[model samples]
Target: MSSPPNMSTTTTLQASPTGIRMITPKSTEEDTRLNQVIAQVVSFIQTNLCEVDKLTLNTGLDIEDSPRLIRVLDAYGVRYFYHGSILVIMGACPLNSVINTLVLNILDQRSTILPHELCPYFSSYRAGILCSGTIKGKGVRPQLRIKIPDDSITFHHPGKHTIYDTIMIEVAFSESRGDLHREMLQYFEHYRPAQLAILVKIEEDLSSRTPRTDPGFRDRAAQLLLRFGNDLGKEIHATYLENSAHDTSVRPEPFTDDEILEQIQVEDWIGTIAADVEVWDLMHSEPRLRGSRTRLFPTPDRNSVPYIYAGDMIPLALHDSFPNLNVSQRLAIDTDLLCMRMAALIPRFACWRAINFFSPEDEDEDMDYNADDDEGEE
Candidate 1:
């Protein structure tokens, strides 16, 4: 028997020129152990436009960006529809690339294994009898005849459905429609699936725990479907309420890090001499202390509140207390005091990501950006 996979090494999918795909482990790990799961995963690669190296990249692979995987899926009987960068498959077919990506990400294991005996599946609607109605030019109107598939596990369909063996995939989205609920009933009555997979996608952010009343419609619809599944003696696998992972609006501005030594040196100096002199004492000793608050602190009023500094503005007051110190020694003491106060205000004035001491918002703006560049890339 071969040894267990080395977790430290990276794992990647490699496609042979002959179209056979294999998992290339960084070490000498065996493929037979994870063949079933790996094959299931390989089947999900959709786009052929991706670079060869991308198959090994750390980023999550999706149908929209992976071009080479796209071509591979086209050959595997999977079809795609694009809405901008986003790609949509016909349905949640088990072997489809999207579903495969979802399952693999959830498992989070490079050598993960899926059940070999998992049921075979497809995306199709129940087709058989056709009922016709007379239009203005048409002569005959006949009653409709619907033919349900003989498979034991089929997905419920309202014209189109994602089917696995005899089971149908049902999805619940954020918005509600009365017509969809009605159609769901009709589909459930016709195709009694032996098992089903219910996928729920909620547009709202799941990170928030704020409670709100859910309109009983979606819950009622789920209940009705679950009841139908139970009556049909089927197994139901329900997924978590999924939200969009790509949100450009959540951008956090990057800030600069403050020098750690400067901050610590300032803090220590202030702690050692905070009680030596007060602000009023410095203002009384120096004529410049009576000037505007803006000149005293130097930073803009919008970004930070101005305050008298012990290092520069209050040097005269420190000199009175430390009469033995020379000019250079007093200057050094003043600098340390200023550093401490500036470090204290860092958290309140700076961006959450960075530790900028007193930088302006304009420092974060990009100067050479173009609208056309963004449009062409999208």
Candidate 2:
């Protein structure tokens, strides 16, 4: 593969089993090639390139201009954060996306979580996604590291204008799992006030969640191929628990998290704070997860995902003020009929994932980028 004279970065055609040949990232290490690709990616993101061929790219960038770069990516919903002088982007947030969508949609359908102080709790119209915002705090090493998580649960400082993310969630796949532990530890140790850090490794490729299932038994898959259009006048009866984890079609391979589950001994991780830490795999009837050594869920059922009490989750600073909210029943993410509703939310999320998957691709065709466009607007 040779780079164009003016462009140092070269792209390769990734031919898929589906016979879909699309452009994906090739090593863009050489600075000359990177400058061009960065320009192109930024240009595409800044201007919604409509009629262009599909190009899935993953490349590194040198941040010479911080403000301008932040504006461009933030507008396009690209995940990025600062690490000292470095700008890190956890691109293609595969598994983290699942819970992000789950929690937000769960809040949307029914009920909310935590303190009532965070007015308009869970609102794009209010706080983008119930505790709307990214995690920002002090002592981020190098004093400039900013971690923009795949999704986060934030809350306002009871009586202050500031918002803080109590639950910092991030997901990584096998390829990117090496740095997962270190990054989280940094967040916990260096970044003060880091309450809970969830690092999940997504072993399966979630480029297309709906299509990631095994072909042999896809019929039994949780979110099968079904055109979910707004009702013209037809009834779409939806049942939550109908799609069991035991369904042969679910292709447990995707949840290749067994090894990860076993290794993340919650005790070693946060056992001291470990008044209680629940770990459970949904695939089986009983939970194989336990704290490094401690009590289990109060009265857990099969449907329960790993849950922690408000007592543990709430910052110790605010514990005494809101004693009533400390119980598990009130603050568990799945407490408010969250399980059934999360299942129903799968269809809507399928559409969202499909759109998000394709939208980030660079438009390889001829397109004009307007640098003057929206540069001065608030």
Candidate 3:
């Protein structure tokens, strides 16, 4: 410094306090190319397709949270479309597989293209549309439906609250050709109203006269029913039995209620359990029911073990329904307890019900709630 350092030396020694580094950003040319490619694909799909209205570019969206994607789509007016596990396109888009292939070809070559992260977005987008109840057309309504057993137990414990009245347990069994459906019917028929509902789904093909047959399948099916179904329901309720075969080619149409009962010898339990739970929960906590209640048994011996029944049907030791309470007063006590139990069960069942059947409105509302919670946390 005393000798007056050269210009080159002074420049080399100069450094900023902010630790800034000089680097070039992506070129305008490259940005133009990428945007052009995206536009081309979107335009091609929209112009040629009959049902497609607009294309959604999920550039920064996280595909894992389907509810978020659905909300975004709803804002943009995307009603219905088919969906897989990933990627969602708007409008009555018919060429879903073809569009997926095209998108993959273009994006797969990129080093940052993560299929795992991207696929679920599209899948959930499609699910959102379906849930919106927009998949209506001609035959069969093009709707998604789950076939539950029309057995007696399901009727009583149709939703989660009833199912979880105590601890819940589930068991699966493989069915045989001619006897898979019949065997389950025979085991559960005796219980009638008291028996658990059996929901049978065909997971594989079980042809009566097929060369490819599973010899152990029938025996295994019978054994499962006898063990779990018979053993568990020895006292409280009848056992539930359901089966599914792999063969879809020769699979018969879903059995009618009467036909299923006649063949399976059980009751029919249908309708949305989630809806029932929501309605029931609201009724239980009503001001009218809460205000008109009085405690008949204020205290019981802590040492006494309460006998828990299948339906949470605990038998009161006192014959008067409410011990030390008069006949006029007993009605209120019984009503209050029944209402409380039902109310408690509704929300529990609603959660379980939502898992199986999600309405579009429900999905949107949930997304809004999550957004609010996230904002609050931040």
Question: Which candidate number would show the highest lDDT if scored against the true structure?
Answer: 2
Put down candidate 2 lDDT per residue, 1-378, tens digits, no spaces.
Answer: 666554425345644567745443323234444445557556655332321211234344434322344555566665455433354443442223345553564345323445445335333111122221323443222222344554555555555655655555554433344344444555455544446554444333234333324343233222222222112101222231145343323322222233333322222111111011223221232223323322212222435445544433445566676654633443334433333433333333333333322222343332343433423221
How would you encode candidate 1's per-residue C-alpha lDDT over 255-291 as one tens digit per residue? Answer: 2234322222222111111111111112332212122
Taking the tens digit of each residue's C-alpha lDDT, what string does model 3 give over 188-305? Answer: 2321121211121112122322221334434333332333222322222212123433331232233222332232211111111110000010123221111211221212122321
Candidate order by decreasing lDDT: 2, 1, 3
- Which candidate number has the best TM-score? 2
Off by over 4 Å in 1: 1-164, 172-183, 192-197, 205-378
| lDDT score for candidate 3 against the true structure | 0.25
Candidate ranking under TM-score, highest first, comes to: 2, 1, 3
CA shift of 16, model 1, Å:
37
Off by over 4 Å in 2: 1-77, 81-85, 93-96, 105-144, 174-178, 205-304, 327-366, 370-378
lDDT: the better of candidates 1 and 3: 1
